[model samples]
Target: MASKVIKIAVPVVIIVLAVVASSALISMRKPPEKKEEQRQSVLVNAETIQTEDLVYKIRSQGTVKPRLETNLSSEVNGRIVEVADNFIEGGFFNEGDLLVRVEQSDYLTNVKAAQASLANAQAALEEEKARGRVAEEEWRSFTDGTAPELGLRRPQLASALATVRSAEAELERANRDLARTEIRAPYAGLVKSRNANLGQFITRGSSVGTIYGTDVAEIRLPLTDNDAGFIQLPDFANDSVKPDVTLTATVSGEVVQWPAKLVRTEGVLDERSRVIYAVAQVQDPYQRNSPDKTPLRFGRFVQAEILGDATTNVIVVPRYLLLAQQQVLVVDKDSQLQFRPVVLERSDERHAYVRSGFLDGDRLAVSAIANPLAGTVVRVSGDTDEQVADDAASEEATALTSQVKE
Candidate 1:
C-alpha cells in the first residue's frame, strides 16, 4: 500500500512541475517585433497623352470597277469579213480604232444605186424647169392678166423638186449604212469579252463584245451610318472640295496603295444593309497617263481609308486600352492606377477618339492589368530599368553555363 501511494504521488508531482516550467517560459519570453508591411508594385507600360488637331480616317473596303463599261453591238446586218488583231478579250484599243468589219460588198452596191437614182432625179428636175420656162413664155405671148396654174407647169415642177429631195434623203441613208459596216471603238478601252468573230453573221443591234474604259476606275465603298457622319461628301449643289481617299490592295504578294478621290455617293441607302455606298474615282487607273504608277486593275479587292474633317484638340487612344463602361486606365503622378471614365466621341476597330474626360499630359496606362483597383501601386515602363537589367544578366549567365557544359 505504501509503494502504490508513493508512485501515484511521484507522477502527479512531475505533471505539476511541467506545468509550472511552461508557465514561467511563456512569461519570460519577449513578444515578436512588429514590422511595417511592404506592398509590391505592378509593372505597366504608359504613354503621355497629348491633345492635337486630329485628322480622322474612315476605313471601308470595296472592289475596283471601271467607271464606264459598255456592251458593243453591231449597227448593221452583215457577215463579219474581218476582225481586228486587237479585238479579242483583254485587247486595248483607242477611239475610232476599227474593231470589226462587216462585208462591205452589198453596202457598196446599195450606195452606188442610190447615187445613180439621185443623179437621175436631178436630170429630170432640170428638164422640168426648162419646160416650165417655155410654158410661162408661151402663156405670156398669148394673153396676160394672170397665168393659169396648168399653163405655168408649176405642179409638174413641184413634183420634180419633191422627187429630187426624196432621192437625196435615200442617198444619205445609204452612205450612213455603208459607214456602219466598219465597227469602231467609241472610246479608248480594253475588250472584256468578244462575241462575234470573223465569218460570223451578226444582225443589227446584236452584241459584238463588252468593253471597259481605262481612263478612270471606280470603287464602291460601303459605309455605315456612323462612318458617314465623319466623312464630308462632295456637294453637288455647291462647289465643294472632294474628300481624298487612299486605296490599298495586295497584288502579286505585294501590298500596293493608290490615291483616289471621293467623287460621289449613291443617292439612296441600301434597304437591306442600311448602308450607303460612296464612289471613289482613280484617274488613269491603267497607268495610261501616269505610266510610272502601278495600275489599279479592275476587280481587285481593296481597302479604302477616307480622310475626314479635322477636329480640334482631341485625344486618340488604342481601342484595346478602353475598358468597360467607357473607362480607361491611367497612371497618376504618384504612380497609382486610376480608372477614368472618358467621353468617347467615336471608336473604330483600331482606335478610339476621346472628346473629353482626360487632361493633356496625363500618363495613360497602355499595358493591360487584370482586376485592377484604384490606388494600386504601379511602376511605369521606364521606371523598371533595374529589374530588366537583372533579368537580362541572369539569362546571360544561364547561357554561359550551357555553353560550358556543351
Candidate 2:
C-alpha cells in the first residue's frame, strides 16, 4: 500500500512542476508585448527657415479722381446759339477748343453801338482840340494885355479830355463782352456732362458742363500712422524717376492693371478716420496720341499697391507660424520642442517678417497642434525639407505672376 501511494504523489508533483515552468515562459513573453504596446508616437509637421527679399506694405482701399477736374460754367448770359460737336459726355477736347456758343448778334450790336459812341466822342474831342488851339493862339496874341473878361478856362479842356477817355473805355468793354460769347476749354480734358444745348437760355455763372483733365488721374489711399516709416518715396524734382507703382481694376470681368506713382500726401491727419491720405497719380495712356495702354479714368475704383521698402536677407515665414500672437514653436537639432518669442517687424495675410528670435536653417512648425508643451516626447514627421523648398518656389512664382499681371 505505501509504494502505490508514493508513485501517485510523485506523478502529481511532476505535473505541478511542468505547469509552473510553462507559466514562467509565458510571463517572459508577455513583457515584450506589453513594452511594444506602451510605446507612444507623436505626430508633427515642420518647415525650414530661409533667407529672401521681403517687402513691407500697407494696404488700403482707394478711389480714383481726375488730377485736374473742373466744372465748366457759362461766364456770360445769353441764348445758346450753337453747341460744340464734341460737347457730348466723354468727348475729348484740346485746350482752347470751343465748347459752346451764345447768340452773338446782340453782342455784335452792342459792340457796334459802343464803337459809334466812341467815334462820336472822338469827333467832339477833335472839335474841342481845334477850339483849344485857337484859344491858345488868342491867349498868346493877348499876352501883352494884362486883364480881360474870360468866361471859360483851360479846366474846360481837361474835362473834355476825360469825357473822351470814358468813351474809349466803353468801347473796350464792348469788345470784351463780344469775346465772352464763345465758351472755350481752359485745358485738354474729357467732357463729363453737358447741362446746356443749342437754343437753350443760359445765365451767367450757370452750370454748362463738367470736364476732367485726361493727362493724369489721382487715387487717394488712407494709411495708418504705423505705416509712415520704412517706405521710400520718389523725389519730385527727379524727372527720370518714374513712379514705380501699379493699380489693378476689374472692369467687365477683365482685370486691367496700369502704372502709377506716389504723387503727394495730405500733411494733416483726418480727424474722423485717423488716417493719412496718400495720393497716387496714374497717367492717362488712352489718349489719342498716347503711346501706351489707356490710362485709368476718373472715378474708377482700383486696388492700388504702393511700392514700399524691400528688405534683403530676411526670413519670411508663413503667418500661421505665430502662436497666440507673439509666440512660435521651433524644433531643435535634438528634435525637442522650444517655445520662442519673436518680434514681428511686418505681417500680412499670408506672410510675416520676423525681426529676431529665429535663424536660417531653423525648423519651424507651421501646423497648429494640441497642447504643445515643453519636453513633450513627439515623433516629428512630414516633408519638412521638401515642403520648405516647395513653398519658397511657390511664393516666388506667385510674386512673379503678380508682377507680370501688373
Candidate 3:
C-alpha cells in the first residue's frame, strides 16, 4: 500500500513541477503574437481572352481521285501494227496523239473497192443519160409537142441517179473505217494501265486499258450533317461556285498542303455513314499551271479544312486549358480561379472555340493544375497581356526551329 501510494505521488509531483517550469519559461519570454497560417499559392500561367472574328472550320478527310477516268477501247478491228512511245502504264500522252495503230491493209482494200464501184456507177449513169437524151430526141422527131414518160426514159434516169447516191454513201463508210485504224487520244492524260501491245489482234470494241485526265484532281471529303451546315457548298442546280478548302497530308515524313475548291456535293446523303460528301477540286494537280512542282497525286489520303462563315464575338482558347465536362478555368479579377462552363462551338486538334461564357480581358489559366478548387488562389507567372503573347510566340518559334534542325 505504501509503495503504490509513493509511486503515484512521485509521477504526480514530477508532472506538476514540469508544468510550473513550462509556465515560468513562457512567462520569462515576451508574449507570443497569434497569427493565421498563410496559404501556399499555386503558380499558373494565365492568358488574356479576346473576342475576334473566328472562322469556324470544318475538318474532314478523303482520298484524292482523278477528275476524269476513262477506259480506252478499240472502235475498229485489226492487228496492232504500231504503238505510241508513251503507251505503257504510267505513261503520258497529248491530245490527238496516236496511241495504237492497227493494220490498214484490209481497210484500204475496202476503200479501193468502194471507189471502183462508185466510178462504175458514175460511168453507167453517164451512159444512161445519153440513152435518155437520144430517146427524147427520137420522140421529138416522131411526135408533136410532148412525148410519153416511157419514151423519154425518165424512170431509168431516176433509178441511175439513185444508184450513184448509194455508191457514194458506201465510199464514205469505207473511208471512216480506214481512218479508225489509227487510234488517237481524245485528251491529254496519264495512262493508268495498258493492255494492248504491238501485233496483238483485237476485235472491234475490245477493251484496251484505262486512263485519267490530269487537268484536275478531286478529293471527296465526307462531312456530317452538322458539319455541312458550317460550309458553303456548290449547288448542282444553280451551279454556284463552291467554297475554298485546304488539304494536308504526310509525304515522306513531311506534311504538305494543297489548295482546293469545293466543287459539288454528292446528290444524296450516305445511308450507312449518314454523311454528306462534298467534293474538292485541285486545279492542275500535276503542277502544269504553277511553278510549284509538287503534284497532288491520285489516291493520296489527306485531311481537308473547309472555310465556313465568320463567327463574330467568339473567344479562342488553347485546347489544354479546357477542364472537365467542357469547362474552362478562368482567373477572376481578384486573382482567384473559376471553373466556368463554356458554350463549346467546336473543338479541333488545337483550339476549343467558345461561343459564349467568356468576356474580353478575362484571364484564362493555361498552366496545369491538379484538383484545383473554384476559389483557389493562384500566383500569376506573367501578368501583362503582351508578356503572355511573347511567351507563346517564343515557344512556337523555338519549336519550329527545333523541327527544322531535326
Candidate 4:
C-alpha cells in the first residue's frame, strides 16, 4: 500500500512542476505593454510662403497746430471805444471785417484841424498870389518903360505855391490817421481770445485779441531717419498727390479723425531727438456755417498718422518671425530650418515687410517645439494644399459674381 501511495504522489508533483514551467516560459516570450504616459511628438504645420511686393517704412508721433496763427494787436494808442460783435474768445470773423475801434473823436478832431490849417494856408497863398501878380505886372511895366520902380521878385510867388502844397499833404495825412483808428481783420479766422475791452485804454502795439486761421491747419509729425528713406514727396504744386493724412484727439474719451495732407518736411534732422519733422495740412470743417462742428483750436493736443507709400503685390508676415533683430527662420523643402539673414523694411505690431530671403509659395514654421531637428518629418495643420486650392476657387467664383453684378 505504501509503495502505491508514493507512486501517485510523485506523478502529481511532476505534473505541477511541468505546469509552472510552461506558464513561466509563456510569460517570458510575451513583450511588455507600453505605459499610457509615453507619447510620440509631431511637428505642427507651417505657414505657406508666396511672392509679393514689399515697402519699407518708418513711423513716429507728433502734434497738431494751426497753419497760421497770430495775436492781434493795436497799432495806435487810444481808448477802446468799440469792440467787434465777434471779438470775444472763440468768435469767428472774415477777412476785412472790422475787429476793434479806438475813440475816433480825437483822430477826427486832429483831421479837421489839419483841414482848417490847410484852408488858412490856401487863403494866405491866394492873398500872396494877388500881391505877387501886381508886383509882377509892375516889374514888367518897368522893363517895358511903362513904369520904373522896385517890385517883388517872381521867386516869392513860387515859395507861396510850395507852402500851399505842403499844407495839402498834411490834410491828406490827417485823413489817413482817422481811417486807421478802426482796426480790421487781416484774414478770415476765428478769434481765440480778447485782451482789450470797451472803454479801456490801449497803446500802440497793445494786445487786442488772438486769432487763428482755420482755413488750413497744420500737424507736425516726427520721423526717424530710417522712415525718411521710403517716402516719395509729391510735387509742391500737386495738392492731390499728397498722402491722405489724419489726426485724432481723444476728447471726452472719444476719438475723432480729422482729414489732413502732407504739406512738407523739415530737410534737416533734429540732433536731440534724431528725428525729422514732417508738417501736414488739414482743412477745418468746423466753420460757423459748416454742417460739421469739429473745432480745431490752436495748441490742442492731437495724435497724428501719415498714410505713407504703399507697395502692391508684397508679402506681409507677422513681426514675430524676426530672430536676433534681422534674422529669420525659413523651412526648406526637406523640412529643415534655415537661418536666413533678411533686410527688414518695415515692422508694425501686426506685420513685417522683408526685402529678401523669402520666395513665394515657401513654407515657414511659425510654431516651435522642443529639440527640433533638421531634415525631420513634419505634418501640416490649420492649412493645406487642398484648402488653398478651394480658397482660390472660391475667390475666383466671387470675382466672377462681382463682374456679373457690375
Of the candidates shown, which would achieve the greatest TM-score relative to the real structure?
A: 1
Every model's TM-score: 0.83, 0.76, 0.76, 0.72
Query: Each candidate's root-mean-square deviation in Å?
Result: 7.1, 11.4, 9.8, 9.6
lDDT scores of the candidates, listed in order? 0.91, 0.77, 0.87, 0.74
Question: Model 3 reaches what TM-score against the true structure?
Answer: 0.76
Candidate 2: C-alpha RMSD after superposition: 11.4
Candidate 1 backbone overlaps, count: 0
lDDT, residue 143, candidate 4:
86
Q: Over the stretch 162-205, how does candidate 2's per-residue lDDT look in tens digits?
A: 87888889889888888899989998888999899889999989
lDDT of each residue in 147-208, candidate 1, tens digit only: 98888888998999999999999999999999999999989999999999889999999999
Candidate order by decreasing lDDT: 1, 3, 2, 4
Q: What is the lDDT of candidate 4?
A: 0.74
Among these predictions, the greatest lDDT belongs to 1
Clashing pairs in 1: none
- Write the residue-wise lDDT of candidate 4 on 118-144 in tens digits: 888888788877887788786786686
Query: Higher TM-score: candidate 1 or 4?
Result: 1
